[model samples]
Target: MVTIHELFQNDGQKSRIGTTYNKILYVPESVLQTIREYLDAQSESEYQGEDNTIIYTAKFPDGREMDIKCCGCQEESSWTEAVLFDEKGYQLTYTDVGEKFEGLWELEYDGIHYCVDVKPERNNSKMED
Candidate 1:
């Protein structure tokens, strides 16, 4: 499992926070690979060479999964975890990814942005909060 967090420097104070994956964000396999490479390269450039900065995890199509490590981009607040839903199929989520948001949405990672269209699950529960 990959664990992703966002680190921010606000008013000279360092803060690290978790990202919320409440929407459907999908990208091509190549794009995802590029992201991993970029992070790996950065890690190699660091002076200390400490490899405990960020973590990465993969999500399966099935619903059985657990939280995992994440990358620095996700840890640095550049990217947030999101679920992917098939417009005409079904919605699968794990502990790492957030809720499912359908329709059109945009995502920007490391100065790159992607547009996706998702079909969210239908809500028919009788209880409301």
Candidate 2:
């Protein structure tokens, strides 16, 4: 099992998909509190949360950069994540899909509240009902 510690590692490793979650889930309570505190400190940071979806620039201590875009946040149901890019925003996609899109993505899934300034898993983008 992938622990919260593993999911939120800040060491610049790209996260891998271990399983598909059936429903929306929050980061473990212990981790949630930590994330909340971290996010609170970055309150001045700006992102797309106001308009439902999220589009923000993320920088890591390891000198990596990427723009994250999360969709379907304003709706009560249905969340769609996008394929994103590295460095400055551009375009990318899973070669298997052949559905090319601009941008590199992050996260085990879409829209995890309190992950405002925290970098998400650089792999595993998806849309779940």
Candidate 3:
């Protein structure tokens, strides 16, 4: 172990940390593809979300599964998150492609490809006059 003085004086950012996954999020195939092509063409999607369903795996190409969150958004902006996990259930990486996700985009992590695709449903109610 390095001392506190050595940490500040010398290189202190040389340590590696490990993490664990407590939950898994999944997304639909069509939804994910749309998100992947967002940069190429700006578009909109209408998702259906009346029931609270906890997704376990995503319907992806090559039959590989991943976790993506699908929440309803009836506002100006929404939040989307996609977490990639290995077969052993260890989280490899994640992506936040909603809200202010712009500029140079890195769609791959640990040799795997992924992007942001949050399916937020819109359920409106009319008031009687």
List per-prediction Cα lDDT, in the order shown.
Answer: 0.34, 0.31, 0.38
Instruction: Summarize candidate 1's per-residue lDDT along 4-33 as a digit string, tens digits.
Output: 465767677755454322223333445445
- Rank all candidate structures by their TM-score, best first, as comma-separated numbers: 3, 2, 1
The positional error of residue 124 in candidate 3, measured at the CA in angstroms, is 27
Cα shift from native, residue 114, model 3 (Å): 3.7
Task: Give me the runs in candidate 2 sitting further than 4 Å from their true place.
Answer: 1-51, 60-64, 73-82, 94-129
lDDT of 2 by residue, 54-96 (tens): 3344343322333334332222221233343434444433122
Candidate 3, residue 111: CA error in Å? 2.4
TM-score of each candidate structure, all chains considered together: 0.20, 0.24, 0.31
Better lDDT candidate (2, 3): 3
Candidate closest to the true structure, highest TM-score: 3
* Model 2 lDDT, full chain set: 0.31
Q: Give the candidates in order of lDDT, highest first.
A: 3, 1, 2
Clashing pairs in 2: 84-103, 84-104, 85-103, 85-104, 91-102, 107-121
Better of 2 and 3 by TM-score: 3
Off by over 4 Å in 3: 1-56, 59-64, 71-78, 97-107, 115-129
